[model samples]
Target chain A: GESVGLHLPTLSVQEGDNSIINCAYSNSASDYFIWYKQESGKGPQFIIDIRSNMDKRQGQRVTVLLNKTVKHLSLQIAATQPGDSAVYFCAENIKGNQGAQKLVFGQGTRLTINP
Target chain B: AAGVIQSPRHLIKEKRETATLKCYPIPRHDTVYWYQQGPGQDPQFLISFYEKMQSDKGSIPDRFSAQQFSDYHSELNMSSLELGDSALYFCASSPVLASTDTQYFGPGTRLTVL
Candidate 1:
């Protein structure tokens, strides 16, 4: 389950509903992780990030939960909106010696918000 | 500051042809990285450059190579391309060498192999 989670490639949710997207990482050594959103015909846009030292981090209407024991990462969006419809991806970083910019990514999950 | 920029926003090539993609890191940034994104998939690391040299390369084939110039710009070269090489290539830049350093990504170059 190392790959990014997208149980449903396209999730249809009524506007204002909460959204939860999951990701599984294989590298337990990954000390840092980030979530990115990519709209159609565009590159990924940075969202929020969480460090291994912490279990959860919250941003404006977004929360990232990290479970080290299960090697799971999840992004929870509160009050989903149409603009939230995009492909979301989670990336892991292992800072052994290669450095910080070398990140491994998981498969993207396409999220759709219904009107 | 302006974000990362990539050249040849779209490219089309035939099998056995060679393709070169260029990237310009963000202003004042020193680290550059290249990643490949297949349809409906996340971006995968291809290679990284720091201090104007190759620092790390993923499981990409030998035909796929990269070079850095003056520690600010980088190029990814694919020689003898195959149909399977078609994918959206992205360039990312980060300021320092810290694990928590945030990475900024370029729009990406869509490569189509015919």
Candidate 2:
């Protein structure tokens, strides 16, 4: 079965510095990728997403870069804040055996912000 | 502006017992999905309902079953719960008619099996 995975299990960064979370997917046919933020005791929240047709997409303070050749994806957060402290997960939208929307998620990267 | 709603903030059951979790999708949303998050792990897809039908099911065991009602409300039933069944369950909804991939999730239900 296809799976999505992250390189780092945890990342620590200064409050004012940038943070990068990396993810890799095994399915080359995946057409869409999304980043989600999960706070303690809460469900995953949609952050940003990019389609395979595009290489990069940007949100308010978040950017997603996708590399098709390497099946690597990254989420970059600018000026990391305390509120940004959470578990980050990347999911890939791929076709299912029954022809449905299937999202394969990575293990996740826990981001910790230092004062 | 109603969002996804899940019932039973927390639940505890003994081994071999059955547990049922519920979810109410945002009104008018055509798609509903269920996910499970084990301790120290990311959310994993369990099953999904769209257009009042079973759309997808992940690699979960057969003991896990789900149903979507005409009102767009969904329920996940886990029979013969085991210790490994302990996890956080989330419900989500999105517009199926649109190509948008944005999914809004509920607060989530924490299940603990003894």
Candidate 3:
């Protein structure tokens, strides 16, 4: 089955440094992509999203780069903070029956920040 | 800003017992989605509803069923629960607009089946 996947299972970065998380997806029909952050025992929180028509999107110290040709996506966080440490997941929105949009999430990457 | 709300933040159920989880979407949001996340795993889509209609289905088990009420709140009912049914259930809601496909997730309900 077509699925979304992450390049690394875990990442470690120092505070004040930049961090990058990568994801790869197989379904070309996907039109929307999003990044989510989940802390321990909590639901995923929306970080940022990018449409397939666009190549890049930016939000509060975060940048999402999408490469349609390779079906790759990356999330970059600036000045990594301790609170930023969590499991990060990337999801692709694919059209389901009846024009419904379904989100397929990738295996998350655990982001660890060191003070 | 309003956010998705989920009831019974935590629940403990015995094997073969039944459990119900409720979700209240943000105001004016007509679409609702349900997902289950196990320990150290990503969220898996269960089912979704659009305007009180069953819109899509995923890896949901036969023992589990869900529906959206007229008021737009959704409920997930699990019967004959098993230990594997213990997980974090998350509810998300979005508007019909395509320009904003971002789904807002609720805090989620933690279910423990013994």
Candidate 4:
């Protein structure tokens, strides 16, 4: 979608349409990546994930693409629905001390589905 | 499909007071993570535990500390609460066997510090 999606802030798409959200990361060592959706006043819900070795992965209506060359990640949602409106965040798994796994989350992009 | 559970969905405290937040992770999950989300801001990682041991630390303040028990449940204890501490706290759990460590989040606890 342009570049490693840096906090687009907001994206509006018509119902039944498709929209793409992008995220960029500087760490090439981050092997695992995840996409989470968070609604108002709610915790983040896992949507999909892709590893550094893979370029694309799909789940339900969501597709996550990883471009290791550019350290870019994008989530494509097909057939946007009303219930899909929420803040989307991209997180990369960066290992800490002793086999520890913690996610480094990017600033989210608020997606609004218009009817 | 059991999801993570967070206690006291909401909490209110006065400045300099103490607060305790608890999290019950999904069955068999070995890792628990905590995050803080300020109003209109993205979630920030606080800390994480693996197999009841401290695994990683993030931007958690000195007054905030957390631990995971043998049962895999975790608690976050905060002292000297400040108004700036008011925010949404989220807990996520993941099974160690999963290669991706896909975390499942529980409904957040909204804490208000007066």
The models' CA-based lDDT, in order, is 0.86, 0.89, 0.94, 0.90
lDDT of 2 by residue, A17-106 (tens): 999999999989888899999999998888999999999999988999999999999999999999999999999876654566756789
- Candidate 2 lDDT over B17-104, as tens digits, reads 9999999988888788898989998788888888888888786789999999988899999999999999999998987833445778
- Candidate 3: lDDT of B51? 86
Interface RMSD of 4: 1.8
| TM-score of chain B alone in model 3 | 0.97
| lDDT (Cα, 0-100) at A86 in candidate 4 | 97
**For model 4, what is the alpha-carbon lDDT of residue A51?**
85
Sort all candidates by TM-score, best to worst. 3, 4, 2, 1
lDDT per residue for candidate 4 within A43-111, as digits (tens), equals 999999988889999999999999989888999999999999999999887777777777778889999
Which candidate achieves the best TM-score against the true structure?
A: 3
Q: Write the per-residue lDDT of candidate 3 for residues A36-82, one digit (tens) a residue.
A: 99999888899999998899999999999999999999999999999
Candidate 4, residues B22-53, lDDT tens digits: the string is 99999988899999999987778899998898
| Native A-B contacts reproduced, model 3 | 0.58
Candidate 3 off by > 4 Å: B97-100
Candidate 1 lDDT over residue span A3-84, tens digit each? 4444556677789999998888887777899999999878788999999999999999999999999989999999998999
What TM-score, over all chains together, does every model reach?
Answer: 0.93, 0.95, 0.97, 0.95
> Please, what are the lDDT tens digits per residue for candidate 1 over residues B1-114?
699999999999999999999999999988888999888777888888887877777767899989989858999999999998899999999887778887889999999999
In model 1, what lDDT does residue A2 have?
Answer: 38
